[model samples]
Target: MKAVVLERFGGPEELRPADVARPEPGPGQVRVAVRAAGVNPFDGKVRSGAMEAVFPTPLPAILGLEVAGVVDAVGADVTGVAVGDPVFGFADTGSYAEHALATTVARKPEGLSWEHAVTLPVAGETADRVLGLLDVRPGETLLVHGAAGAVGSIAVQVAVAAGVRVIGTAGPGNQEHVAALGATPTTYGEGLVERVRALAPEGVDAVFDVAGKGALPDSITLRGGTDRIVTIADNTAHELGVVFAAGPQQRSAERLAELADLAAQGTLRTTVAATFPLVEAAEAHRLSDSGHARGKVVLTV
Candidate 1:
């Protein structure tokens, strides 16, 4: 199978198109003929070795985690998924390839495209997890930082659907876009706290910080506690007593199915910021690393 292999992690340029042995499914896994792969910030972190201390990948690792494709093989113990099934999920062996392996997956409804389905596993799962972690209930106000980006935007819609009022922070250009997602949007830099306060006079019930642009302190002040504040971007979460919601404690196949159903029903949505050919995985990673992409970046295989 052809894949964008990282001979050694360093930069986006390290991802090179090459032929590699196709991966076979292990126990409880399935092999997929990958149609598209989602490029995320964590993929860049893995490629650049920034997450080496926590997520160490060996040399010549494939550099993607989420994929949408047709399943061609299923391993022992696997159930509810089989050959010829159109599916999307997280891949343990990486997804930037012609074939990928997944231990858990959900059926891709006909309404969802490959590019869109591929974006859900990581970004959608994380958004749902943080909202669950906060136990954000209906009739409460929530503040979402980076609400215009992939994960943040999904978080906004999920919260809104649950009847939680959302106040999202984004660039001026994205304010209206966030508003369309059911949040009162505000610009992200200075005066963010004041802006949020102005929007939610009763104060926010919880804060979801996905941008990590030094907003943790203000979020703490607004929420009046670190218990209700969670972040995926800020490493200083521990120092500030905030929960670093990085692990997959709240993730599950059932949740992925629910998200896909929402997307299929036009309830949850994500824009394709850019799409690159399989050979141009490097460019996709560069766009993701730029931190300016307005939506999910994907690689068509």
Candidate 2:
């Protein structure tokens, strides 16, 4: 199998294309002939060794979190899903390759493209988890940081669909785009608190900080405290007494299936900012790390 391997954790250049042994599924797992892989900010952190304390990847590891592809083989104890099924989910091994192993997967809807399918697993799971954790109710006001980006955009849409009023923060270039996603758009930076306050005079019910660009202080101010505030990208979460949502606790095949169904029904919109060949995994990481990509970055096999 042709895969990009990280020889060492330092930079994007550490990821090099190599012909490696294809991964075989373990018990309760399946091997997928990957069609597309989603490049996440977490992958960049892993590649650069920033997540070592939390998600220690062994040396010479293949780095990818989510993928969409066809199941080529099923391992013992696997049920419902079979070989030849089109699926997408969390990659048990790594997804930046021609083939990867998956323990959690949902059948891909026929109406969804592989690229779009790959984007759902991580972003959908994260957004749903944070919202649930915050206990956001319909008619409540929610503030989302980085609303124009992949996960933030989905979070905004899902919250809006649930009847929550969303105030999303993004760049000036993406303000209109955020508004279109059913949120009142505000630019993130100084005066963000005032802007969000103006949008929600009753004050924000919860804060979803995906940008992690030091927005926690303002979020605390808006929410009046750190309660119901969750951040997926901020490293200062612990120091600031904010909940840093991580791990696979909220990921499941059922949730992914719901997300896939919503996306297939055109209720959930996903954007692919750019596509790179598997060999250009390094370039993909660079783009994702730039934090300026307006949508999900994908690698095509």
Top candidate (lDDT)? 2
Instruction: Write candidate 2's Cα lDDT for 170-194 as tens digits.
Output: 8888888898999999899999888
| Model 2: how far residue 1 lies from native, Å | 0.9
TM-score result, candidate 2: 0.97
**Ten consecutive residues with minimal summed lDDT in candidate 1?**
245-254
Candidate 1 structure lDDT? 0.88
User: Backbone collision count in every prediction?
Assistant: 0, 0
**Every model's TM-score:** 0.95, 0.97
| Deviation in Å, model 1, residue 244 alpha carbon | 0.7
Which residue pairs in candidate 1 collide? none
**What's every prediction's RMSD, in angstroms?**
1.4, 1.1
Q: Residue by residue across 140-226, what tens digits does model 1's lDDT show?
A: 999999988888888898899899999998888887899899999899878877888898989999999988888999999898878
**Top TM-score hit:** 2
